[model samples]
Target: MTDQPLPGAYWRLWFAAAISNLGDGVFVIALSLLATRITDSPLSIGLIATFATIPWMLFALPVGVIIDRVDRRKVLVIADLSRGVLVGGLAVVAAFWDVQIWMLWLLAFGLGVGEVFFDNGAQTILPAIVPRDQLERANGYFSAAEVTTNTFLGMPLGGALIAFAVWLPFGVDAASFVVAALLAASLRGSFRPTNSVPSTGMIDDMRGGLRWLLGHRLLRTLALVVTVMNLAFATTQATFVLFAQQELHISDNAFGPLLAVIGAGSLLGGIIGGKVVGLFGRRASMLTAALTPVFTSTAIALWPVTWFVIAMITVQAFATTVGSILSVSLRQQIVPGQLFGRVNSIYRWFSTGAMPLGALLGGVLATAFGLRAPYFAAAALLLIASLLVATGLTNAALSAALTQYSPVTTEPTFATDVDTEDHDTDDTPVSIDRDPLDDLLAGP
Candidate 1:
């Protein structure tokens, strides 16, 4: 397919993501700093990160069901508004006096709840806004915007803002959410699933989503791999500040620029990610992406120098962005629209949800061993995950799965033999093909 510009609605959504992530990037740095200010312990920092991520494990299924049943635009609006008010309120509070760690933990949890809905809605609506062929490009646009705002502007600016006033970053974060909400409201057309069946009970709906994922061999294995990788990644998130401060001797004032460099790497990756995927092909691209963190983490662990670590992070960001563009585009193209939210949530429930555990592990490992220990541990875990992908995710396997996949259709059953109920709202009848790879990929 020839490359074409994405539709206006998609760009609107893209703009909204850019705005929101810009604030989110600032919020990440600000939050980490706030935690460090309140308590210098690694576990305290881990707790902050855990509160932000564990919501995915707790609410992914329900949020997915909600995204499927409602107009996705409304979901985005609500998420943005709620987050704006909540974080904005925190800013107001912090302006008066020193904020407490307990308060940060609570606010982080609340923001995470909003993210569960917002992120699911954001992913679910992409196929509706853009055609299947442009998915990689569309995703590339979104990733670029996200990394730029969340990392490039947000990270360094956050550090600077904190230096100006501790509460300033939070205020900026609140404003970004408000702007994002407005952008989301301008998007036209219905985003609800056209082929979704009536409620088969929340449990059944949730079960159906999980079963659909399990029925797809490649999808299932990928989700598991994402989970393990996320766990390793989170270790860095939870303790990177301490590592930079203690191990590398970077001062607080300069930390933001260093963090911002990570975003700079990701930004470059996002801009060229689709091209990389095209040149490398899916399997090779994905393998490279999977192994990237392994090598980067190892370099940081072994060398622990400032310049070397920065270079590795840039390479890691670039590789992961390419992989994400290819993988997310494939999933969006193949999964039925009605089931996309739920399936994507299930996908995230594994991939994103595992971060809390990793964060906790980072704290524990750092406490028991040393700050550098988490990097060593992360490298080890990532190496094993990469090896798994190299052995299991072959090109033939991906091609076979892609061959059997189609957009979600109104059918009596999904990828498995699970019974499906028809709704009067369905647009057309479609059935998902069950590949024999299910048995092999899903494991015994």
Candidate 2:
């Protein structure tokens, strides 16, 4: 069946996401550089990331319940507006004063809190805007926009602005957030999930979401694997700036461009992700995604050359993007829409929640051993993740999940005037072979 064009509301969401991500790209580079100015300690620098991500661990579950209860659009707008105000305040403070490390840590924590709400709301709202079959393609557009704007455009811009003044990038980031909030607010729709069960108290709602995810073997296993994968990635990421500066001898001016180069691969991955999944089945693509990081991390650790490290990171980003697209699309296809916010939150709680610990671990490892140590540790962790994907997330298992939840018709009802009726033209189910989860559950 020919694919229907994405709706206007989807485009608005896309623009909001792109603009905000652009700001994030700039904010990331600026924040890292600002933290470095305050303190050169690897542990101290890593703590910035730890502070930013700690909210995911503390607030994700309860926030998930809130997402299900509220209008996701309002949640997104409020989150963006709040971030804008907070960042704007930080920028004003940075312009006048010599910002301390503790101040940066506090700002990072505030931004992280906003992210916990904005990101989860955005994901939950997508299945409502776009059809089930078009999810991969729709997600591809979002991923591409995020990478292109955030890294390709915003990152280099951030580095340049930071060279001029530390406050500049933060100002730009704040403006972007405000603008994104405006665009998000313009999206005319009631984005509340229409089919959610009546709240049986917040704790019970949270538990129901948790139980649904845990009971599903594939999603459960995938969530655990991602938890470890995020840990490995964060471990390397926490001290990457130090590695670039101390080892590769990259100047702050050049650091953003180098990240932009690595982001080129992510851009490519987002552009072609849907096609790649179509070409290679989910199993092969996921396994490839799992294994690519192992080699890349090992190579970077061993070589430590500027060009070589960039090349390795670029390749890893491509594979990782494809894997991420597949995983999100799979979840949207199978999970009930009413439970999407909660389930997705639980999944992120397991995966993203590990980042703070990993960031701390990276700092400790880099401080005690060397900058190279985190890369080696990442390689080992990724190897284990690869094996888990190879053994547990087989093609048969993925197919079974899809078969059980075919023609994914349980989506949040949007009150928009734009006609989305054409998006789901093909509702025919594919033939199911067997219950793949049953075999896995009954394993020897």
Candidate 3:
């Protein structure tokens, strides 16, 4: 592996992800607006958002096994093609036909199903395309691209475009998917099957992925932290709508600009994650890691006006940016290459599975208690997770746990089930792309 991404493959992934996430961002904001226009109930929108996790939760594990056993490139192409059709077909229904709330629910269900394959394939396939040491850079680039779409371009563009024609955003969203599918079609490389574990049956594959995750203490801890954060954050999207409507006194469709502002924050945060790892040192990164969400959450709890709310949302995006880079890079650095797909699948499943409950709890709290209450709960949970991680692992230990390539690493393994980057029993950054612990695995 080299320090930079394989130029061609990386660009291919970049274009595909950018176009797809852009469409997704646009569709999500538009969907929220559509639901509100069709019915006055915020709760319905909230419920719909809650169930958004169903695809990831239900299909993730199976998708992981599939990613492991099949050619990753093929998986991506097929998933993108399916999604393009679905989005385009839905656009017609939303644009021309009458759309019921239940229909929207059904659309969500189908979209969720495809997401399982797409999301799993994307993350698991990334390491194969880039050099090992570039994990931070790769994660940063990916997050930055997504932020550009959802925040800088997609969310605002989608909402603004919708004012022209209700179907415009949906149509645009559909178009993005088609473009993504085409881009995916060009990526080379068939994740060639190795005789390592020998492809097994479905139930065995599931058990293998699960068993791998449970076997490692660091990964176990990391999974728990990620799951908790996701559960707490689940209430965020629903509560944000309430806050915009009631507290800020804004219309449902007008928050697109604000969301875009957050995208800027996310962009900055993501760019800094790579620099932060080098400057602050990974050990010190943990305590500082807690600040962005804390800042974002506390400010939102204060109930600012539209401008202030925009700033707070920006902070949340920034926090998400940094958090994503740190966690993802850490996992990529540590996880065993062979089982990386399986372990990541479990992680996705838990996060997505928790989303529905989080959404429901948020909606309930807003209607029964108050709109701002969910923010308080979300902030508290983030704070707690931060504290637990700090108290449990020393900074040096934590850094090593995250970046070390040895068997001491707790993340899931890669497909090759081997680490051959630096064969010596040394424990330092071996090269620009190779970590000291990489040679421990019996991989290709």
Candidate 4:
């Protein structure tokens, strides 16, 4: 299985992901630039980021349940189409009228909603499509595609497009989403969970996942570590545009290119992430990932030189991408297929949910101290997270967890046993002789 080529359907999914992420890259730069036009207040600009990420905190649990119940391909299609409509509508509005800060916030929030479903669904569906031995390689491809399109190509293109007109980037973003949607819809076969049992209700399902994650030491620690890491990173992200303009003395035209430079490291990391993990092993890889940001954040805060900042951020992106690939692959390998959506949502609910608060904190810090304040704060927080990772994610612990929870068979249940016609596409329960989580939890 490891030597075999990835199936054609996987490529279709990959293409759809690449195209949509390209639009996302464009959308991120364009949105920030537009917000800057409306206001100079760092707090207001930060609020836009806050709105965009708040949905992961608010809606992740329910959306997780929804992903497990429906055809995941349909979820991906609907999410893309909805985001396209929202972005297209925003483009039309921006062209005709004076765009307000609140409007950008609203648009960001809507897009965030679509992302909650789409991201989780994509993660849930992958193990079903490719062989288990190839999960790391497959994820590396995804991470590479996302980095290449979203940041490398999309970011620079966005900077150039915004120079033409405000509405242009948004329009391009809308079109990308629509095309991605069509490709997602073309994927064949049923993607419903095979081990889905009679419903104990949504709340119960959510609790089940939460309990399993909380009970597992390795995963639980990783989730918490990611939460702190994201919090620290988000603080820098919320204020980075302002920092570039003020401290680094970068021009608006150069902003996208600077980001693209940072992305180059991530692209490299994504391309070689699996190999790095295999070479160094997960514990060492994860520790490096945790520690790199601490020095990088401090360097940017102290120096703020353009070349120095780029160098530090590029290194930071590389380490972060490697850690992310390892973490996601580990989760996919360990968690039961039926519980993947709910557990993943819970995991992200903690990890990504902290971004809004981080954004708000960045805004406040910048307003009170200075633009550089957020970077200093991020450095402090990330240092603590690094310490946690150093102590908690030991090589022995990671190996034990993998040995305990790895699936008994490589074949996914959805490949054969799932009856597409009779699949319960709603909250209604179906009978199973034993709970999948029983086996998962029973492992020591």
Candidate 5:
């Protein structure tokens, strides 16, 4: 059967996620500035950043259970609405009263908590709205929008809003949350499974989810790789603003274009992810994607503040996007329907946990070695990161599995999966017959 069009509810979720991500990006700019204004210490900024991320590390698994148990639409609506109010409060504090550094940490924590639910709901709800066949394209576009909002728009817009008034982005951000809330609440279809029995306890469910995630060897390896990548990503993020300003002499004006280039690359990469996934097959793409980040991040560290880093990162973003989208979509595709949420949580927890540590470490290292040194460290980590990913695919667990489970190599899995589902819709490179994992892990 032809994949039916995405239902109205799914559209609402997509739009809501997009807008909410945009607002989050703007608020990040505001928070960083607030930290700087309050205390000039890199350590303080790192601490605030750590707080903002700590919730992700702490609450991801619990949040997944909540998302799975509740009406996802409602959970999304609540998250959006709550964020709107929280941000609005920040705006008022910034505009009408003096806001403390601790308050910034509080706000960041609240936002991060809200994000746990929002993300869990978003990832789970999509499968309910669209046919299994169309999930990749949907994921690709969704991933692109996220990159656009977080990496591309968050700082630049935040900076711009701060220029107009430090409080303005928060106000606008609050308003965006309201829009997102309304959008989320307006979705029509019910997403919860019909089974009357729900998990009895939060802790039990969390452990069950974690067990399933870690028990699976392939997924467990992938999670470890994700953790390393996240650390690299967080470290770069912690240093980027300072690096841009100090090394490249990138003013507020120049930063936007530099980021925009990366976003554009992501957009292109997103559009083409499905084709690549189909051609390279999921395993190869994941390895490539993991490795590509190292190159760009290393380039960022090695190159003095020049147009070169921007150009390199832009190219890097597209390659990185291809790898990431493929990796995520592949993980989702292979995960059993029942275990998807928890597995994602497991992946998330590992990845998210790395952020705070990376940011904190970046600050410490930067202080000692200087701004450029962190990038060098990050680059070396990324090269090691690539090896970690390569090891994951070749591991004993995947080796036994891939040898027995041969994909239809001749016609291409992408042709079958895509033709039946999203013919001509995806730009991802996919070749059905070739399994990179199988190549190395040819088995017993």
Candidate 6:
């Protein structure tokens, strides 16, 4: 299974996501730049970022349930097409008249809603396309394409496009989404979940997904570690601009290129992720991911030098990307197909839910203890998170969780599902086992 080439459809999916992310890269920078034209106030910018993220906190669970019930491909197509129209409309308006701050906020929220659906659908559809043995490779490829487009190429292109015209970047984003929708449509097979049943009410379904994830020892522990790490990372991100200016004395112009180091590192990570995971195994790979940020953050706190920050964050980005590839592949392996969307969404909600709080904390801590304070605080938090990962994500725990946990199995309705059935081939009922953590917590 590992030696076989991925299917043609998988390549198509990969290209589509990559193209879409390229536009996303441009949009991320351009959107904030456009908002600055409206007003340079940090509050206005914060509002834009806030609204864009609000949908994730608000809609992730419901959208997850929706992904499970509907044809997942349709969700992806609809999400892209809708976003295409929305951004296209923004381009038209911006070209004709002055863009209002409120209008930008509205567009951001709309785009966020679309992302909530597209991302979950995209993730949920993968196991259907690739064999379980190949998930790491598949995810690594997807991650590489994404980081290459969105960050490496997208950010700079976005800045240049904005310089060309206020409306140009939005128009480009619109075109990309339209193209992505077409690519999604070209995928030849059905993407409905194998184990999905008729709807049992959204709330009940959502609750079921949440309960399952919370009860699972591996998933639960992973989510906690990610949440804390994300908090630390986001805090650093939120304060970085100020920290760079005040502490490192990085001029405005050099900031973007310096930040690009993160993208470069992620690109390198994505390319190497499968091999690293293979060589080191999941526990050590995950531990490496959790610990690298500690060193990077501590360096920033201690030195506040521009070149040092760039180098350290580059390493940090690589480590984080490796962690992400492995963790996502692990979840995709174990979670039930019918429940993947809901459970995955719930897991992410917990994992990234700290972002807004961290953003706020970064600002407050920066003001209270100075720009470097956030960095120190982040390093301390990440150190705590690293220790948790070191202790919790052992090879034994991962092995036990993989063997003990089971996804709901159903008869295949689609051709591809039948072919891939052997990969998900078990219909064996797995009884509940005592959580591995209980034994660990009992101190042997």
**lDDT per residue, candidate 3, 1-444, as tens digits?**
134333454554565566667776778778777777787565676677655566677788888887777765566667666766776777788778888888777767666676677666667655654556677777777767766766678778878877878878888877776666665555433453343367668778888889877776666766666666676777766656557777888775677776676568777876676776667765455445554566677778776667887787666666556666777767667766667677788876775677777777777877777778887877887787677567654676565665555423333333332333422211111001110000000000
> Which regions of candidate 4 are displaced past 4 Å?
1-5, 408-412, 415-444
TM-score per candidate: 0.89, 0.93, 0.85, 0.91, 0.83, 0.87
Model 1 misses residue 333 by how many Å? 1.6
- For model 1, how does the per-residue alpha-carbon lDDT over 1-444 read when each residue is reduced to its tens digit? 236665655654565566667777777778777777888899887787788778889999988988888777678788888988988988998899879888987887887888888878877655654666677877877778877776778778888898889889999988887887776675445556556668968888989999999998888878877777778888876888888888889988888788778667667777877777777787887888888888898888889899998899888878877877777887887777778888999998988788888889999998889887887888888887787778777888788876677653421122211112222212211111111101001110
Could you tell me how far off, in angstroms, the CA of residue 224 lies in candidate 4 after the best superposition?
A: 0.7
TM-score, cand. 2 vs. native: 0.93
Error of 2 at 246 (Å): 0.6
lDDT of 1: 0.73
Candidates' C-alpha lDDT: 0.73, 0.79, 0.64, 0.78, 0.64, 0.72
Residue 36 miss distance in model 1 (angstroms): 1.6
Is candidate 2 or 4 superior in TM-score?
Answer: 2
Q: What are the clash counts of all predictions, listed in order?
A: 3, 0, 19, 0, 20, 0
| Candidate 6 lDDT by residue in tens digits, 119-162 | 78777766665677778888888778877777778767877888
Candidate 3: regions farther than 4 A off: 1-8, 399-444
How many pairs in model 3 have backbone atoms within 3 A of each other, for residues 3 or more apart or on separate chains, i.e. clashes?
19
**Candidate 4's residue-wise lDDT over 1-444, tens digit each?**
164666554565566667777887788788878888899899999887788788999999989988878777788788888988999998999889989999988987888898888878878766765556667777777878877888788878888998899899999989988887777666556767666677779998899889989999999999988889888888878878889998988888999888888888888988898888888988898888888988998888899899999999889888988888888888988887788888999999998888889889999999999998998998888888888889999989988988887643532365333322232322211110110011000000
Q: Tell me, by lDDT, which candidate is best.
A: 2
Candidate with more favorable, higher TM-score: 2 or 6? 2
Residue pairs with backbone atoms closer than 3 Å in model 1 (clashes): 336-408, 409-430, 410-430
**Please, what are the lDDT tens digits per residue for candidate 5 over residues 1-444?**
123564443454455556666776676656655666686566666666677678878888878777656666677778878878988998998898988888977887787788777766666545544455556666677666665775577657877888888789899888888877776555444545334246778888789888877777776777777778767766766756567767888766556556666567777777777677667766677777777767776777667757688677667667777766655655554555455566677678887778788888877887778887777777777787689777777645554644433212211111112222342333222110111011001100
Candidate 5: stretches off by over 4 Å? 1-13, 147-156, 394-444
